[model samples]
Target: MMHSFGELVTKFTSYFNVRHFPMAPSTLYDPCEYFLGLGGKRIRPVMCLMGNELFDKITPDAYHVANAIELFHNFTLIHDDIMDKAPLRRGMQTVHTKFDEPTALLSGDVMMIQAYEYINKVRTNTIHRILTLFNKTAAQVCEGQQLDMDFEKKETVDLDDYIEMIGLKTSVLMAASLQLGAILGGAGDSNAKHLYEFGLNLGIAFQVQDDYLDAFGDPEKFGKQVGGDIVANKKTFLLIHALDVATGAQKEELQNLLKQNEDDKVEKVLAIYRSCGVDEWARSLKEKYVTVAFQHLEDIAVLSVRKKPLKELTSFLVQRDF
Candidate 1:
């Protein structure tokens, strides 16, 4: 029943394709194409268009702006892969790992520039507003990434701090995506602001869900290594919960699990996490965020018909497997 939002995005992307590269381009173009071609949920752009449609019709004008969001997101991914030293993106070779770090860096930079170029396709006034939003979101994303990296070295990251970090690192772009869509579709300032809040809340919930999935999800349905966050020593909800709840030997065991280098490290960590009830704690946290997200959606004040597709899209996003 059209479970994949990327299917809609794939159908729409052909129209956004533009030819701007100089002849016989370097390897930079290859990484751009490689990462972009390896499809994703396209939740951001779809929300953009849906936001636009809430105020006006979806047309070519909307596609350019929506596509810019996609470009900007991919730009972030390429740089993030390098920063994370991640070997795979969407289950395939990462740009930095497949090519080289230098190539990936240059390609990521080009993608950022290309994102601007895509935004410029809109008219002059829209370009000004869109670029302003894009610039702010890009900078904030970098800030968020830095915070995430910093948290890795830290021992006491609170829930509030983590939320703020995700807000900058992940949620702002989503807010911008919806605002851009609303702006493109001729929404009033109030409506645009509300749509942005909706996107922000949804983004937070989606990220929290990712954390829950890392520790509690069925691997067959989730389509990745379970307890991956634990294995990588990533600070996720499960880890955070354990930090808050475990005491004495349990704390020591968790700490030891975090430090251990073994073949079944993830399995061992999950066993401990389950025994400590971190899984249930994390699940409750995920649900809390999801409830808040839907509350924001309800407060959007748009007509129900206008909001239906957007709500459907958001439901598909947070409920999806992997």
Candidate 2:
């Protein structure tokens, strides 16, 4: 019987919420435990399960890989919070903020090692391929994060460059997660590649939606401060597109706004975005990527009935108000 997304999410979470570490040194393990306790949607790991189920029955290897993907994803979040120096995650103190930086770093390190331990539990036949893909994707994630940092320093970032950075930072892991599950489910290489493409485009679309929400969403529903990205001058698709399409006084004003951290900054910038039709453009850009993602999903040689959950997931990712 095919498992729905909710069924798999319940299955995965039950398995994940376990005694994952020894209780000797409270420093490292405590931070790890705290961060994991800050629950998320667990999208990547569940996507792996969905990938596996799409082609065939979920395998023993898929669970192991799904666990690994969840661990690895959390590992990145721990480090990312530290690197971003974010004080809060899900309204709780971050690992680095609650604990020390050194401890947080080590917590991230141990979590990554534990992820590999889970990876090693997969079947012997698929172990090598899984490791290769996971490793490559991990490296790419680091590289993408570096590019995100580097982009913050540069004066002007091209649209293509920003897309490339997000593709590496946010898209690769999702793609790899799905592909890894596909391989474990006995899919051929071509089908695996199609699933990866589906994931990649969907990931990009997800990021676009997230970026849009940061500017346009209600603070109450969004669960984060509106205009956080704008106040920080982070290069996002909307800001980048606004710069591209804006002209004359609007262009000059936009350039000036980027240099300051003023209170009215978000309002002024969003006004410019609206003037340049950036909000509309962002919606369509997200739709463009979503369209491509769905096409790739359609190409995966599976029965249509098996694809319902992914399509629902894709819709939810792109259409969320929060």
Candidate 3:
């Protein structure tokens, strides 16, 4: 993954940086540089490049599209961190935390605009299709974030709602990113749809795998604090599974813990989840979704050799520990 992406990152980072000027230091430019400089895995853009390469030769213009996705993703992250009141991201200070809330918000807006500028350079014929998908996806992502916040306030969330939330929040962008690449690469509508479905399924499985890692991953490999989800009373798969399988007292205990104020939140919720076999249930769900994702990828109707990297990407994602 890093092979092509390292060059793209260096190229685009320079491009974005040059667009920022030698104007004297101020609150305005700081957030832009801060968040961009903080850096991340740059996974979304790389996925875009890889998706394009699945059909056509790698193009420098593909880097622009990929950069657009990266900017948009980082924009979402800035806003999300603000909403989550998260202090850290990518193991560094969050944009909102490092600067102020207002700066973070403005910077995020600027990033979104910058993304549009990059996307505008896509071929004129494909621009309409690309923007249509991008706009719908951006809207869906906001809707997903709203649903996640709504989940925090809800007493009970159904499984369907949970699945839909993840689909919109995480999966849609992955689908869009791949679809954009395919669209630009001259793929027909049928192939684009297939690739989009492949990405969506992979994304759902990825989220499920993340949930499993929260409970079962090796700490060193997983990074950050394990069981952080339990501490927050976030309605992950484990919690939902425990809600269904837990006996009367177990359900009561879990609910009581959610309602309680204690430092042992992680320990208590994890104990309840273990008793209900919620971890195992979550692992099974993850595997099921991963299998479904792979099946979708396999059925894409592309030549086997052309599909190999995508399959490898899926394998790495579903089986990842960190």
Candidate 4:
């Protein structure tokens, strides 16, 4: 029988906690352990297991792929935090901040290698296909990150460009996670492709919601500074839209806000965003992507009951305030 989303998460977490890592080098492995132990939602791995279970039982191969996905996700987070100079993650110190930068960087690199080690454990006829998808997704994630960094320096970034960057950097791995799970579970190429599309759309919607929460979410629930994106001049959807639509004094005010480092900077930028209706636009766009994601999930050739867990997971994701 298929498991509920919560059960799947619990099972994955338990399996992950007991998995052995090398003990010889305490510094390198300790940070990896600490970072993993910080306990994210484990959405990618859970989705991978769900994708596998859609066609067949949750096999050891599914666990291996899920482990790889989780490892890679954390690896990216470690490096990303370093690049962003972020101090906290999951309400704890970031790897780079908790440890030193050099150790954190090396730890992240080792984690990537270890991800492949799990990938190699798939023991399937489609291992090469899985690796191909995995490698391509990995490369696109790097490209997306580079594009994001480049955007911070550019004066103007098109909305389409921002979407593409997030899609590559954020969505493709989610898509690949589903595809990888589906392939290992003996799903057909068509079903696997549809699942990938479902993940891609869902990932985009999640990122859009992230952009929304950065500005409007309650600080107690948001787990970080509410206007961090604004404070850092990150080219979020709201900021980008505000830039595109604001004119004359409004535009000048927005540009000036970007240059300032005052305590009221977040509030000033948000006031400008509200005037331009960027928040409403972001909500509508987020709903649009969620609708498209459900459509892709519907296109999958499975019983409606088999689709329930994914539906519930999607609902939980799109509706979350944090």
Candidate 5:
């Protein structure tokens, strides 16, 4: 039976709500539970379930796979919070802040190890491939994070370099989630590859939209600090593309804005972004990647009807405020 992304989200949330850790070390397990309770959209795991249902009936194994994917995703978030020194996540205290860094680290470690245990529960014939993909994607995510940190120290980051970082940091895990689910659903190698490509492109588009929203969306609707990226001087689609296409005084003005720590910095930078048409470019870039993603989804050898949920999911992701 096929399921829309929303249906799969409800199904996955039930399984994900359980305590996956032991009760003993409250310092460790309590933080894990608290962070899990923060309750994200469950996008990655639900994508996994949707991938599975697209090819065959939903399997118990798919839930296990989804559990592992989500646990790992949250584990990354814990570490990301620590690295960013983020005090809040989902509008609550971050794991490191509420508990302590050491305890949060241990909690994240347990979550990651438990993710592997969930993976071990899957009885798919493609188990080895699943293990390999999971491990590789995990490392790529770390590599992307490292690159992002590295870029922060540099003066100028190439637009291409920035793209590579987001693809590694943001896109690979999402790509692997779909491929892993597809493999479990009896997808042949070619079809699985197409699905992976679909996810990779979709993830890039998602990041582009996220970066755009951080700069331009309503702080109330977007639920994030507007111009947060500019404040951090983070490398993003708009800033990087503005650097690439801007010229002479506009280019010089942007570089100076990047160096300034002032109340007017966001407005000044956004002025340049509008002048250079970076915001419009970001929308087009997001759509470009989403279009490519759906084309790959089309290449998957499933009945056309089976493709609807994925198409809807992609549309929802890219169409959000951009």
Candidate 6:
């Protein structure tokens, strides 16, 4: 019997909510607890468990790795919020905003260490392989972050470069999370690799959808300011496509919009995006990646029933309106 996605998420949440954290040095650890307590979709960690269960029953080692992945993800969010100067996360104050910056930084560091501690608990002969992949993925994420910051300063960014940046910064961890669980569940190397591709494609599609939603989604459902990306001059896929296709006065208007710090900037930039067919292009691209992701899932050499939860999860992620 296989668990549904909701069942798996509930099981993982119950287990994760009760995990122990250090009591000493209240400042460092308290923020960790607070940040983790602020709930998220828990997609990455749940996908780890799904990867394991796809091959065999969910094991204790799978739980350990899932916890590690969640810890590491939260750690990244803490530091990223600081860098972005973001005030809110999941509708609450960010760690750096609620606490001091130094505390938030140290808390993030401790979370990384704790993540490794959890990884060390995995009683598998393939530990070295898993650690290597984890380290490489971490480094790539940092590289991706740097590239993203660099892009903010540049006047023009190519579409391929943007995709690569997102792949490294966002997709790699998602891919590694699934691959690590598959390896721990005794899946063969080829199937594990296939799972990684499935995650990678799905992650790319998710990010593309995110870019779309930031401009077109309803403000109430979006949970953040719609057009926040445009105001910040962030080089999302839609903006990049708009720049590439817009001409003459339209391009000039976009350039001026990017330079402005006004309230109506989002509406104006969205008008340009629509006129340039950027919205349609982004939607088509998002669907393309989703199709590729489903194809990879189909190639995984598992029974169709075994793939149901993951397929449903992927569908939920890419088709979400918020």
lDDT, candidate 6, 153-245, per-residue tens: 899999999999999989999999899889888988889988999999899999999999999988898778898789888889998889888
Tens-digit lDDT track for model 1 on 88-148? 9888999998899999999888888887777878873677787888788889999999999
The residue pairs that clash in candidate 1, if any, are: none
Error of 5 at 162 (Å): 1.2
Clashing pairs in 5: none
Listed in order, each prediction's TM-score against the native is 0.91, 0.97, 0.91, 0.96, 0.97, 0.97
Clashing pairs in model 2?
none
lDDT for 316 (candidate 1): 72
Question: For model 2, how does the per-residue alpha-carbon lDDT over 194-255 read when each residue is reduced to its tens digit?
Answer: 99999999999999999999999989999889999999888999888888888889989999
User: In candidate 4, what are the lDDT values of residues 128-214, reduced to their tens digit?
Assistant: 998999999999999999999999889999999999999999999988888888988899988998899999989999888999999
Prediction RMSDs, each to the true structure: 2.7, 1.2, 2.7, 1.3, 1.3, 1.2
Q: What is the model-wide C-alpha lDDT for candidate 6?
A: 0.90
lDDT (Cα atoms) of all candidates against the true structure:
0.78, 0.91, 0.80, 0.90, 0.89, 0.90
Question: Scored by Cα lDDT, where does model 5 land?
Answer: 0.89
lDDT of 5 by residue, 24-99 (tens): 8787798999999999989898888887888899788988989999999999999999998999998999999998
Worst 10 residues of 6 by lDDT: 18-27
Candidate 5: regions farther than 4 A off: none
Model 4 poorest ten-residue lDDT run: 15-24
lDDT of 3 by residue, 45-101 (tens): 767876787778766667778888988998999999999999998889998888899
Off by over 4 Å in 3: 1-25, 261-263
Residue 279 error, candidate 1, Å: 2.6
* Model 2: residues with Cα > 4 Å off, grouped in runs: none
